[model samples]
Every structure is written in structure tokens, then in C-alpha cells.
Target: MMNNATVFTEFSLSGLKDITTKNRVILFSLTLLCYSVILLVNVALIMTIILDEKLHKPMYIFLCNLCINSLYGTAAFYPKFLFDILSDTHVISYIGCLLQVFIIYSYASCDFSVLTVMAYDRYVAICRPLEYHSVMTRHRVAFLVGFSRLVPLLCQAIVVTMTSKLTLCGSQIEKLYCDNWSILKLSCNSTTANNIVGFIVIFFYLGHNLFTMCSYVQLVKCALQSREGRKKFLQTCVPHLLCLLNATVALLFDLMYARYGSASVTQSVKNFMAVQFLMIPPILNPVVYGLKLTQVRYSLLNLCRCNKQVKGLN
Candidate 1:
């Protein structure tokens, strides 16, 4: 047996090992297509928001941050995933695995943090319309955005740093990608410190969810009492609600699978549960906001029409 101080150099990812060579090609093509669409829609929405002066509002600013985060989160996984699908070997360097753990978890943490801020933004907008401008000022919005990004970066950095110091006994990870928990499971020594910190991070985000729910609960109660409030709720809050729900479900699926998923479960099902978070939110978020938000939809249409006109003139 390796001693406690011994370091592992690499890990074999067993998740994709079940995939046959013939199926890998098919899966690779489909994954490439999905990744491309995610990139296109997210980048398009981000650029649309950036270019249009009309969308320079607090709400749209939050939405833009959300889209940028989607891009950031997906970039950590899809490129390496696509490469792995084509290659026969499913291995990641120890350092590379730790980096993936940091990026993936931080991306998730950032999502929850951003959503919590968005909920607060909506709460202030609907529940305190007169004070919305004063409360969600440019400075405040910038601060909130920075807080959302920085907190996750810091938290995940701590988690990853803690994880990297541990002496790992195993080198086989049973997942499609490197996950913090999976890496933790490989430790031969007691992971009490890891578990405590992990729970703290988990509970921190759980509080974010609770805060969001409370905000929406109050927002819904206020919206119920007025016609204009209902209109605003339907126009603005519904998309945010949809996004929150999507993210919650995706994260839950991944969490459940990570904690209690069984080998008896069909590999296909297991694979779906594993990657659903990566696949769904990155693509669906921009689509939901783009279609549901009137300003964004109109801006996208105008941008397309101008492109077409320029092409015709050329």
C-alpha cells in the first residue's frame, strides 16, 4: 500500500470507458453539435446585450452576467469532454483534474450566487419600484456582480487548495469528468476537513436558494395584489423563475447522482444524470431569456435584420 504522503500522478476516468468505439464517434458528433449551439446562443446573447445601449439597465446587466457565466461554466467541460470522446484513453493529469474540479464547482457556485443577486434585483424592482433606481444603482450593480464572481472564485480556490494537499490512494474516478467529491473519495486518509468545508460551501449556496425563494415569495405576493405588478412579473420574473428552476433541478440531479447513484443504474441513464447540468443550463438559459424578454427579442431581431441588409448592400 502507498503511504499517506504518496502523491498520485494521474487518474483514469472510468465513466466513458463503457462507451464502445463505434458509439464514441456518434456521441462525439452529437456533443460537438450541442457544444456549438451553446457557444453560439450564449455568445450571441452576450454580444447583443453589450452592443445595445437600450439594454444598459440593472435587470439586463444581471442577465448578461448570467449568460457570460454560462459560457464560462461550459468552457471548462465541453472542450475536454469533446476531446475525450474521440480519444481511446480516458485519463487526466493530477493537476489537470484539480483544475477541472476548481472550474466546474466554481462555475456552479457562481451560478447560484448570480441567481441570488438576480432575485434580489427583481425583489427591489417589483417590491420597491420607486426605490429601485436608488437601490440598484450602477455602483451597487457593479459591486453585486463583483461579489458574485469573486466569492465563488475564493470559495472554490480554498476547496481546491485543500483538496490538492491531500494524499490520494486511488487513481480511478468513476465519472465523465473530474469532480471534487470524486477526488475526495480517492483519499486514503480521513477527509473530515474536506467534508466539513464541503458542507459549508453546500450550505452557503443552500442559503442563496432560500433567499431567492423568499424574495420571489414576497414578489409573488405583491404581484398578486396589482395588475401592473402582474404584467411586470409575467414579463420579467417568469424568465428568472424558469432559469432558477432549471438550475436547481440540474444541480440536484448532479448532486443526487454523485451521492447515491448506483452501478445498477443503466450507464446511459447515469451518463445523462451526470452531464445534464452541463448540457441543459448553458443552452437553455440564453434561449429562455432571449425568447421571453421582449427587449432582448427585439434587439436580436434588429441585429439580424441589419446584418441581412448589410449583406444585401454588399
Candidate 2:
């Protein structure tokens, strides 16, 4: 079954047609700008942590991982989108589609995993500041990072392997990019196994990780009895909570949407929201962190200065 499915050479993509030409041009420009900023900002975040050994603690380490995942997520599809806009091609090869799904899932899932780990790190730092160093030692930090990548890594492998066996005939995906549920909808084979595995994975992975984060939140609150500590705790959790809410909504919407079909107009509106869930998070992340963290703002200022100096030298 898998071998035969792989033998089918090509797959058609339902192009972005509902959007007007003006909208397309605007979207193209905005997406390009957003991706460029996402890349540069995330790379800067990573480099800042790497260069500054003072920031080598667990929090910064997790932040670096988060930045990398955000970069990967935005980069996975943005370039292809730009190419499609320029070349006017709506079709993608089956292999290419699978690759897209794999890369996007890897980045996105890893991002969530890293966020969960980061919440724990913050909890340790704030809630148990006395033992923060002892608890989050270098080896332990490395383990968390490795574990974050490992979960998503294994999940993506399973999804791709399973999906490769299923035949996609008669239906083409209608999104700007190929998403998991959307692609699964096209499978000629029964999706019972896929749905079950996907649900189990989400429950085990997202559910548990999110629960851990929530537990840390409560702990952080308990530790923050002092007025200043309570304020700082709220400040730290706000951005993460917002991102988490956005992600949760997007996931639920995708799952439910797959089960119940929407009207064409409704689907279009949902598509717009879907893009928001995917694109907004990465873009908003830097903004959120920038607004929340003093260090990130200072780093941005320094980066601007360095760029100005380099341009003058050039």
C-alpha cells in the first residue's frame, strides 16, 4: 500500500484564488517582510545568547531554542510562498508536500516543547531561586533541549512514515500550504488509525506539556507572595500564555474543522484565521519578548547601532 502510494508521481494544490490580486500582492509583500524580520530577529536572539556567556543559564538556553524553532517554522513555508507568488505555480510534487509538512511540524512541535520546558525553567528560577543553579545544571539543560527536539522528531517521523503509505487521490488540499489534517482529508484509505494516533500524540504531548506549564504557573504564583515578585511573575507569564492560547485555538479549530465541513465562505474566513495562527505566533513572539524583556530591547538597540556602524564602514 505504501509503495503504491509513493509510486503516484504528482499531486495538485488548490491555489490561493479567493484572495484578490491586490490582496495577493499585499500578502506577498507583507509575508516577505515578516519572514525576513523573523529570520534576522531570531538569528540575532540565538547569536546574542551564544556570544554572551553571562546568558548561558537555563532561561536563555530555552529562549535560544525557541528562537531557532520559530525561525524554522517561518522559513519552512514562507520562501515557497514567495516563489509561488512570483512564479505563478500552484502545483507541488508529492515529495515536496511531504517535506513541507515534515519541516513545519518539526519546527512547530519543537517550539511548543521548548515553551513547555521554558516554563519549567522559569518556574525553577522564580519559584525556587535558591536551588535554581543546582536544579538546572548544564547537563540537565542539555537534556531538556534534547528531549524537546526528540518528541517532535519522533512524532514527525511517525506521521511522515504513516502518511507516505496512504494514497491521496480525488482531493487536493485548499490551503496556501499543506497542513496535516488537510492532507489527511485527501487520503483514499481509512483515516481511523491516523486520527487515533494523532489524537493520542496531541493528548500525550500537548496535553501533558501544557499541564506542566500550568502547574509551573501556579507554583510561580505561590512563590510570588511579595508585591514585586507577583508583578514580575505576571509579566513573564503573559506573553507565553498568549502564545499558548493562540496555539490551542488553532489546534482545536483544525481538529473540529476536519470533522465538520464549513461553508465556502466560512472556510475562507477560517483560512484567514488559520494563517494568523501559524504566521502571527512567530511574528508576535519577537514582539512579545521584546516588549517583555529589557535585555531583548537593549540587544535590539545595540544591533541597530552595530548595523549603522557596519554600513558606514562599507
Candidate 3:
């Protein structure tokens, strides 16, 4: 007799495994509200950047990219997630799982990449003020944006492609959303290539963060000597650091939890760990940048004031 290996065409998400109907309804409402806020704030910030001609600099440009990418990343998780919150079955087709893995993972990798570019922009603005305009010209800004997006996307495409080739034996993913590590764990085949590439991607992730940290160190050294430098550092660099820390910490939590979290951990904790990166950063980044960056803050306020005045006049 020949033994046939079990194959799975779909996966069950056990993150919502034990919730009652009342809890599910409450969770769905809360999730919808969160997603709504995320869309509203990010969209507002993006429009504030686009409409105000004065805000059309490298810094604002990159910040806009950050907000847009936040939406991109969250879209991967939120719609499907909201549906799953109400759903009793909590199932996803294999292809759907792969799509989620690609979008969410690429979003994370790209966030780091954009932050690194933004860090370089700040360094040049503060440290090499004389050449700031020359260095971060329109062409260069465009190139940096493309580089930040393309490299991460390309890397994630490779990872997700590798994942799609695997023959999964188990059909249950323990976490809230589709994750590469969870899928990899399900594979009966050797994950040597996936691990190697995943580590390389992680190394590059760390590389982006390390580069940003070093740049900020140099920035702090430069800012101490001058009042204007200190102002710029406070106004701009501080928010960037907040965003960096927020996204990095959130992503690290998810990554660590996905690969090494104890199965005995409570499902609620697992859900939080799984979704923090997706939930927090998308909403947080735009709000932080909007409040902390003066130009954007003023523009947003004016935009709101103008809208109210128009309403009154109408």
C-alpha cells in the first residue's frame, strides 16, 4: 500500500477560534471604526500634502508616500480581516493567503526602505545644508521613492513566489492573518531557500534601521551646535523617529510572534501580536507626521478652517 500525503487547498484561521457571537459583533464594530479612522487620517494627510504647493518638498513628498503606503499595507489586512471578524468559518483560499502574505510583507519591508530614504533626506538637510537642494532634486527624489518601493517589492515578490511553490500538509494558520512563516511551517518540504531569503530580507530590514539610527546620531551631533538645526531636529526628526520606532517595534512583534510564539499563548494576545503592525502604524504614521511637522499641521488646519467657512457661506 502506498501512502498519500495530505494536501490542503485552503486554510483555517484559528485566531478568532473561540469568540462568541456577541464578542464577534463587538469586534467587528471596533475593527470597522479603526479602519475608518485609518482611511480618514491617511487620506487627509495625503491630500494636505498634494494640494498645498508650499509643501512640495522632498520631506513632504516622502511623508505622503508613507501615508499612501500605509493605506496600501492596511488594505491588505483590513477588508479581509473585517469580513473574517463577522465570519464563522474563518477560511481563506490558498491563493488569497498568498496575496495577503505578499501585500502585508512588502508593505512592512517598504516602510523601512522609505524611512531610510527619509532619514538620508534629513541628514542632507541638516548636516549638508548647502547641498540639500542640489542633492535632493526632483529627479533624485523620484529615484529615491522608486528605489524604496521597488527593492522591497521585488524582494517580497521573490519570497511570496517561493511560498507559492510549497506543498502544504496542514491547512490551519494559527494567527489572525496569512503569514509566510506560518505557511512555511505548514509545508512538508524543506524551507531552506525560504529561510535563507527570509534572513537576507531581515538583514536588509535591520540594515535600513541601523542606517537610520546612525544617521540620526550624526544629526544629533550636528543639531547641538545651532538653534535652527535644533529646531529642525525637533520639528522633523522627532516625528520621524516616532514613526520609525512605531513601525519597527510593531513589525518586530509580529515577526517574532509569527515564527516563535508559544502555541500555549492566549488567542487574544496572539491576535494583538499578529495585528499590531497592521493596525497601529498605518493610522499612527500620518497622525504623527501631521501634528509634528509644522507645515503639514498648518496646511491641514487651514484646509479644515476653509471647509468650515465654505460650509457657513453656503
Candidate 4:
């Protein structure tokens, strides 16, 4: 085993080794298409929310941030992933690997945080209708949005810093992208401090999930008591729930794969498990909110019509 003093400069990603040259081209095309669509849809939704004065409410503002985050998260992975698919070797430089870890994990944390805030927005709208506007004021919403982005970036920064300080015995990362736990697994020294900090971050985010659940539970209780409440819940809260469920399931798959994944698993299955979170949630969130929210849908339609009219006038 390499000792603490051993210097490693790069990591070879073994995840894409199974692809044949012919298959690599095909996969690269498909991946590029997927990434393009993720960008197109997310950008469209974000622009729709930003340009429409009618969508400047607290709920839409939260959604705009969520969409912005989807773009942020995907930018970290998709470009590099597409390049890896086309290249003969799948290796990432040390700094590149650490940057990926920081962006990906921070993106995950931010997803949960944004969803938690969305749940709170829904709860206020439905449970405390009279104070929804007051409670989720423009200033308060700005603070919460800023908080959602800042906290995750800060937490993941510490994780990346801690992981970077470790002396690694090996440089093979089993997955297509760099992950914090995977790097931690290569450490030549004690990782107790890292593990403790990791667990604390996990439990903190888990608490965010629990808070979301409690909010929904109360939302369900309140929704059932009134017809209008039920309508509001179905209109707004359902999409939030779907986004939450998608993010939760995607993260769970990633967690399980990182922890107990076996070589015996088929490469395709392993790849799917490894990237499910990165691939699904970023694409799914915007689609879900775009289709489910009436205001957003209408706004999008109006934007389309206005664009066509401009084309005709020109």
C-alpha cells in the first residue's frame, strides 16, 4: 500500500472502460443530446420566470432559483462527461476531480435546501393563507434563496477541503465522476474526522428532508378540510412533491451505489445508478414544474407566441 507521503496527480475513471469504440460514439451522441435538452428546457423555464412580471411572486422566485440550480448542477458534470465519452481514456486531473466533487455534492445539498424552502412556501400558501404574502415577503424570500445557495456551497467547500488534505494510496475512481466518498475511500491516513463531518452533513440534510415531510403532512391535513385548500395543494404542492420524490430517489440510488456497489453488477446498471441523480433531477425538475404549474405553463405559451409574432414582423 502506498504511504501517506505518496503523491497522486490524477484519477483514472474505470466506469467507462466497458464501452467499445463503436459504442462510445453512439453513447456520446446520446449523451450530448440529453445534455442539450437539459440546458434548453431549464434555460427556457428560468427565462420564462424571469421575464414575466406576473411570475415575480415568492413561489415563482423559488422556482426560478431551483431552475437556475439545475443549470448549475448539470454544468458541473455534463460537459466533462460528454468529453469523457468521446475520449480514449477516462482520466480527470486532481484539481478537476476535486472541483467536480465540490460542485456535484454541493448541487445535491442545494437541491434539498431549495426543495425544503419550496415545501415551506407551499405550506404557507395553503396552511396560512392570510400570512403567506407577509411571511414570505420579498426580502424574506431573497434571504431564503440566498441561504439555500450559500449553505450548500459552504458545506461542500469544507468537504472538498478535507478530502483534498488526505494522502491517497490509489487514484482509481470507480465511477464516471469524482465523488467525495470515493476520494475518502482512497485516503492513506485516518478518516475519522472526515467521516464525522460527513455524517453531520448527512444528518443536517436529513433534517431538511424531515422538515419537508412534516410540512407536507400538515399540508395534507389542511388540504383535506377545505375544497379550495385541496385545489391549491393539487396545483402547487403536487409538483413540489414530485420534485422532492425525484430528488430523494435519485440521491438514494447514488448513495446505495457509492456504499455497497459490487463489480458483479452489470456495467450498464452501474453506470445508470452512478449517474441517475445527475441525469434525472436536473432534467425532471424543470419539466415537472413547467407542465404542472398553470401560471408557468401559460407564461411559456405567451412567450412562444410573442417570439413567433416577432419572427413574423421581421
Question: What does candidate 3's lDDT look like per residue over 1-314, in tens digits?
Answer: 01333766789998899999999889999999999999999999999999999999999999999888989999998999889887788999988999999999999999999999999999999999999999999999999999989998899999999998887778989878899999998887889999999999999899999999999999999999899999999999999999999989999998887887897888898899899888899988998998888889999999999999999999
lDDT of each model, Cα atoms only?
0.90, 0.73, 0.92, 0.91
Compose the digit string of candidate 4's lDDT tens values, residues 1-314. 54445688899998898899889889998899889989999999999999999999988989989888888888889999988988889999999999999988898999999999999999999999999878998889989999999999999999889999998988999888999889988888889999899889989998999999999999999999999999999999999999999999899788777877886999889889988888889889999999999999999999999999999999
For candidate 2, report its TM-score.
0.87
TM-score of each: 0.97, 0.87, 0.97, 0.97
Candidate 4 scores a C-alpha RMSD against the true structure in Å of 1.1
Query: Candidate 1 lDDT, tens digit per residue, 1-314?
Result: 34644567888988887888889989999999999999999999998999899999988898899889988888888998888998889899998998988888888899899989999998998899999999998999999999999999999999999999888888989888999889888887788998899889989998999999999999999999899999999989998888889988998889867877887998788888988988898898899999999999999999999999999999
**What C-alpha RMSD separates each model from the true structure?**
1.2, 3.0, 1.4, 1.1
lDDT of 2 by residue, 1-314 (tens): 44334445655555565566777788789878878888777787788777666667777788888887887777768888787766555777778888888888777778778878877876776777789889999999999999998889899879878887887754477777777787787776789998888777777667746676676667666666877667756677667767666666765565566566575656456666556555777767767776777666676667678889999999
After the best TM-score superposition of candidate 4, give how far the Cα of residue 202 lies from its true spot, in angstroms. Answer: 1.4
Q: In model 2, how large is the Cα lDDT of residue 278?
A: 57
